[model samples]
Target: MRFSVLSFLTSAAAVSAAVIPSSSSAPEKRGGSISVTPHDSYSSSIGVLGCKINTNRAAYWPSSPDCNNICVKVSANGRSVNLLKVDQSGGAHDISYDAWNYLSTGKNATEAPTAGGGLAATYEDVPMSECAHLLKDGKHLAFAAANSMNFITSCSANTWVGKNYALYNILNTQCTWGYDELCRMPDPSQGNQPICEHTLGLTVALKTCPVYNIAYPTGKLSIAV
Candidate 1:
């Protein structure tokens, strides 16, 4: 696998949070407001993590990745729905228009719902396996490598895989060759076939990718060819 020096630097430059291990504690049920957001090309397809999500389904953007690809059971307005965690909202739960409409009217609507404040709701994390039916075919829940800097970058997603083995091979090559270099994988959500050529700057290569152990949404999810 060929690795690009520039791509690694670009990914590293986008890094904001320090390289810390993902939390291992279980996610507890929480109450908050589920804001309604318009569905657009980006929201319907490319998420902040560069993953493709089915907006037509009960999809939502959580404030973080604690529920990434996990099934979240949300209750509001005397109605309940199971939402698939697909993107980052930076605020409280921001749900797709379809999800909000269903919660408000108890039925799916073709037109967008009337704009308003978030609906008061409570949500709890459920395993991804339970929500697998909601995801599109060829999509799967994948964990991020510990040093992947995924939280702050849009070039990669926990679940997005390169159409081919390009990105996977690049990471594997770097790991096998013991190259301590930062690298950017292709943004698959941007197009059907993309080249892995973006750049991220770094003088020294980061540590080897570690197998992250997380507790919630239990299962070993991996990025594959």
Candidate 2:
């Protein structure tokens, strides 16, 4: 086993080069209380999804260099938006570059994302003309009453917040029918529920919420808008 100096040098160089970016281009302190310009709400017509985020919205750094998972809030023109994150390959950011860019630099986000354009753009503030999920955020924000539920062995129809909401079975993503069954619980049960992306995405608790605030019924957690 004669040692090849060239091979050894090559391996060392490659490994050393890989460590450079990690030690050099560390991501900046992400997530803070920052204000954004007052742009129109994200609409299907304009090509954005989710709630019409204003200054009152809260965001999480899901992936931030700060060990605290600590997010500092900021505003622009008195509005706040969260910065989605990017850590590994094949992530939500790849599909939602517009959102990513907006989080990166709030100045441009104030402007409209490309209308019917593809996601991702050069920071020139121009339309990509390729993005198509503009209507996605709206669906995500639409708070419709839970007509279905998961993981619930049973459920019942009740008037919550003066509206009708369904309590259903727990449906974790173990099986298709199980998930479906969980979404449509017409009875009541005690257990974990299979909550889907759409369910979590839409916290329609306000439209049909619980009647009493057991947390601090006597003091705080009062049932009020």
What CA RMSD would you report for each candidate? 14.5, 21.1
Candidate 2's clash total is: 51
RMSD of 2: 21.1
Error of 2 at 130 (Å): 26
- Decoy 1 TM-score against native: 0.45
Kindly provide the TM-score of model 2 when superposed on the true structure, using C-alpha atoms: 0.20
**Clash count list over all predictions:** 15, 51
lDDT assessment of candidate 2: 0.22
Best by lDDT: 1
Native-referenced Cα lDDT, model 1: 0.38
TM-scores of all predicted structures: 0.45, 0.20
